[model samples]
Target: MRKRALDTVFALAQQDERVVYIGSDVGQGTLQGFQESIPERFFVEAISEAYVIGMAAGMAMTGFVPYVNTIATFLTRRCLDQIAVDLCIGNHPVRLVANGGGLVYAPLGPTHEAIEDIALMRCLPNMTVLVPCDAEEMERAVRASLDWSGPIYIRIARGGESVVSLPERGFFIGKAIEVRQGEKLLIATTGVMLQTALEVQDIMARAGYNLGIVHFHTVKPLDTAWLANQLGPYSHVASLEEHSVIGGLGSALAEWLCENGDHKLKRFGIPDRFADRFGNQAKLLSYFGLDAASIAKELQAWVKPS
Candidate 1:
């Protein structure tokens, strides 16, 4: 997804001279390509995310569209004042292309993990929070952010993901995309968990249980009307993500449904515990019961009445 986003920024920069790519002294691999392509427009700051955001805001003041890239934790957590005051409050057209969203850096420990980025960014006024499910969606998100008037926060995983079905054969901002149809349960997911959701859908279908999958590419400004119509009838709902349950995708959905619509819902993601051991991505996800088998089991158990 980062690679696709870099390509997207490059393409957008080429077409519109006003587009600029800013970096906060990170992401060497992807930044190399952007520098090689558009050296004049790309700028890398020295170890200061706050300054990077301030600089981007300064550029935006001159009508330049700057897409800042860095790890999610540092980009949002470390420099929120700059982000909130300089960009979001001013409604600047600065795009924040954040990577390592959720626990992607689980082996690197909790400090690097960006579990609360979504909630933090969503709380800021005039900020658009987005977490694309795959590379294609990432590309679409980049294009969508270009036309956006205010600051945009795009949370993405470290690597590529499988392509899921779109909403009725298309994509739209501030709208929920339904991936699959099921009768037994509904799983609404964001980030890389869409892969696990699809796999769970297949396994449940084989077991004669139908399910519905809603891929929510847009986290903030959630499509409550669409969710109300789609999830209104379902008796059971499971919101999944790769981040902490505190203020991520699941929490966002649960809050929306709790206030505006009436529904029974549960969240499935990394539990409210920091990982004590270092391991690969697959092992970390499995440790948190985010794997397909665990999710399927949870869903099947939910189907059984207490």
Candidate 2:
């Protein structure tokens, strides 16, 4: 997914001279290609995340579309004031490419976890939050962001994600993509958890539980009308994400459903408490009941015949 995003941005820079890439001490081998291709446009801010945003904002002020890549926590949590005021309030064409979203860097402890990034960024007036489900979606998002005129947040999983294989034209900012068709339950997922929802849908199908999957890749300015229509028939609905249950996708969906009178929903995500244990991504996901087995168990208990 990271490679796809980098390659897409590099390709966009080839055609649009307005595009630039800036990093906050990010010298990964994956970024080497962009540095080689557009050395004049790529920059390293030497660990100053706030300066990175300031520089990106300065570039945007001069009509350059700057894309800043960094760890999720540092990019948003550390430099939030710059993001909210400099980029968002200014409505600059600065694309925030944040990797390791939603505890993908769980092994590094809470400091590295970005469980509330979406909620934090979504509060800004002009910020557009995008959580691509896979590499293909990330590529599409990159292409779209090149021409986008305002600030945008692109949250990507760490690495090693399956190909979503959706058409380029099919990707839209305010539309939800229906991945599967089922009868009893609707699975609304964002980020890499959308893949998990697909796996769970297959498992539930074999177990005779019909499930519908809706990939809500865009968290901000959610596609509520589309979601409400799809969720109208299901007796039970599930909202899933890799972020916190508070003010994240679960809360967004719940608020939308309540405002629209769509109820009987289940929320699956990280709890409010800080995760004290240090472990790998899979372990952390399992510990939070975000693993497929645990999610299935929870759904069975909640959706049992009543």
Candidate 3:
């Protein structure tokens, strides 16, 4: 997914002179073709994340659309002040290509994980938060960022995610796509959790429960109109994400339900705690009861009557 997004940025740079690529000490030979093609517009700086954001802000001030790539934890935790002051304050057209969102860096421990990135980015004013499900959707998200008016924080998982998003459904920023249609239960998801939600949908279907899954690719400027319309038809609604249960897609939906309507909502995500153990992404998800089997079991308990 990361490679696909950067490749899309490179493709866009070929056509648009305003496109610039900046990386904060990423792996060697990353986007080598882009650097060779557009030497003047490509930069691979040291581990100075704050300085890199400031540079991107300056480039944006000069009417250049800069795409900054770095670890998600560094982008959100290390450069909060620069992002808040330089990007959000002025609403710059800087695209933050954050890698290792959620527990993608689980083997590297909590220091590298970005479990709270969504909460951090979504709270900033004028910041658009996106979490594409797979490589194909990441391409669409990258393409959409080219014309976006303000700063965009796109959270992507490691490569090799399943393609749950269909081309026929189309891609639109701030629009929710309903992948499955059913009554009584609504499973709203963001990021790679859509894949788990789809699996849970099938599991519930086999067990005689109809489940609907909605992919919320854009979280900040949420598709409230579509959500509002969809919320009215379902008796139980659940939100799933790889992020913390607070201030993420689930929290956003909870807030909207609080104001606009009344519905039963169960938010499935990382609880309010740090993942101190060292393991891969699958282990962390399983530990947090976010795996497809665990999610299906929880949903069965929630949807079934006492």
- The TM-score of predicted model 1 comes to 0.94
Q: Which lDDT tens digits does candidate 2 get at residues 1-306?
A: 887897888899889899898878876575787788789998877988988999999999999999899899999899999998899888999999998998788878999999989889988899989999889888888887787779999998968878764784378886888887777788989989988998887777777788988888888879987875677567778999999998888888888888775468889999997789888888999999999988988888788632
Put down candidate 1 lDDT per residue, 1-306, tens digits, no spaces. 888887898889989998999877765566676688779998887888888999999999999999999899999889999998999878999999998898788789888888788889988999988898888888888988888888999998868567765534555778888777665478999877888998998878777777888888888888787787776447788999987888888888878878876567889987777777678777888888889999888888778521
Global lDDT of model 1? 0.84
How many clashes (backbone N, Cα, C below 3 Å) per candidate?
A: 3, 0, 0
The predicted structure with the larger lDDT, 1 or 3, is: 3
Cα lDDT tens digits, model 3, 25-144, are 999999999999899999999999999999999999999999999999999999999999999999999999999999999889888999999999999999999999999999999998
All models: lDDT? Answer: 0.84, 0.86, 0.92
Quick one: best lDDT, which candidate?
3
* Best prediction by TM-score: 3
Worst 10 residues of 3 by lDDT: 297-306
Pick out the ten consecutive residues of candidate 1 with the lowest summed lDDT: 162-171
Model 3 regions more than 4 Å off: none
Q: What order do you get sorting by lDDT, best first?
A: 3, 2, 1
Winner of 1 and 2 under TM-score: 2
C-alpha positional error of residue 277 in candidate 1 after TM-score superposition, expressed in Å: 1.8
Ranking by TM-score: 3, 2, 1
